[model samples]
Target: MVLLGCLVEAMHANYHGSYSSIQNRSSSIRVAHCMTGTPRTLYKEEVYTAYRHQVLDVLPGDLFVVLEHINKTEMIHGTRVRADNAIRYKSALKYLSPRIVEWISIGDSLGSIETRSGYAKWKRCFDHIQRTERINGMKYDFIVRTRPDLYFAKALPKPSKLPKDKILINPYYECVNDIPSGYDRKWAKNLDLCDLTNYGVSDLFAIVPRALAYPYMCVAYITDLPLAICGERAHQAECAIKATLHKANVTYEFWPFVVKIKHVS
Candidate 1:
């Protein structure tokens, strides 16, 4: 009887020891880069190539790419190029590789209401979050919202320093000397930080915790933006997003990142 009891105790200890070791192994931060929106003027091949090296290869977590299927023809470098949604979709799957948790393809048509395109873009991002959670049964610690048209020259800043209740955003270019003149310089400066004016936060890239990700992404659905803002789609989206965060009492941090726009003009 004593020998049997001793054997059970030894087995229990070994099992817990193994469990602890497994936990330790996976303690590294888990991040998810959610790339949303249409592939407009960007070259699908080159964009994915840079994404492979900059994001997938460098970042140490899963990727979820959500692309809208919009068949728009535009001139690229004075050459007419038909942006084929199907080809770009395939290219993403091929290049993103093993780190991709799922590639969500959403329809291109903006619904009955002819709202700004930014509304649709934000909606797609929200959909990706819901779909990813359903598939994995777990949420990512950090979520990055960015577009495909922008090319990253280096890996994104790690998310270990971000607070759970705050959203991290990329710094906007200074207004006085950065942007082409004629616009309100004071408004531009205010826009750089989260402010009440409708100038808008930088819409290029944002890193947020799971808690704030849902609210930030759902800004489109909850609010109806003004006509002036709607006219400027990107800026309107940024304003709405920042406003959402502000309402929720979620703070923000500005992190500077220099990226090239893959526009062939």
Candidate 2:
């Protein structure tokens, strides 16, 4: 009976292996998108030009931009920021004046969005991307989630090798060990290859496959982690979590040291 059971298991394994080997490879074209919104203060022409100059420097051609705002009509109608404003100059380059390929904006209150909180806002941005993908029949090999308020401290790191599992910003122990720690523990449990340590916070700065983002969107939500405030204060929580977490695979790269800070003030 034991030998017969072994024979059955081996046959099943072989059949499954053959089936998986024939699966088609996903597309390699990647789309790196930034999700931005308006700041509290109005900008002068020089400030706006400087902002545009700095923004265009780090932006790549292969990107899908998403601009979120509290009010779109007010913005486009010139009641908020004014049409002749530099904000318009930047917005025009992407979606309004003359869209040059991959830029768009959605009213913050429109659609099924969640922007009041940090974590919710990030997930809502992911949701927007997912809906856009479905509508346009677009599929990406990689999806980089970036923030608009961010200033590049260095060059973006080349993406790491995509593992068979999800690439998390934190360490690999939480998933492998089946232990409990960190914020959003439920979110941690749902992931196959995840980190409770950071909850992929640096993902404000991430490069992940589109496929992985689907499951993560529904499950592996970002939790509270140490954050760098204007490069002055490093959130100690994330630093501590990172220090304690075990490193199994080299799936993430820290890039703050490399980003060239173009705007400050």
Name the weakest run of 10 consecutive residues (lDDT summed) in model 2.
11-20
Error at 20, model 1, angstroms: 24
Angstrom error of the Cα, residue 262, model 2: value is 7.4
Which portions of model 1 miss their true places by more than 4 Å? 1-27, 41-45, 73-83, 98-114, 176-198, 224-235
Candidate 1 structure quality by residue, lDDT tens digits, 1-265: 0111111111111001010111112436656676666666444677778777766555555555545556578799999998766565565665664233222244433331224444445545445455555555666677777787878776665444456776767555653224322211223224433432545666777777877666566555544434353234435546665555656567776554555668856
Flag regions of model 2 displaced more than 4 Å: 1-27, 37-62, 68-116, 135-138, 159-164, 168-200, 215-264
Best by TM-score: 1
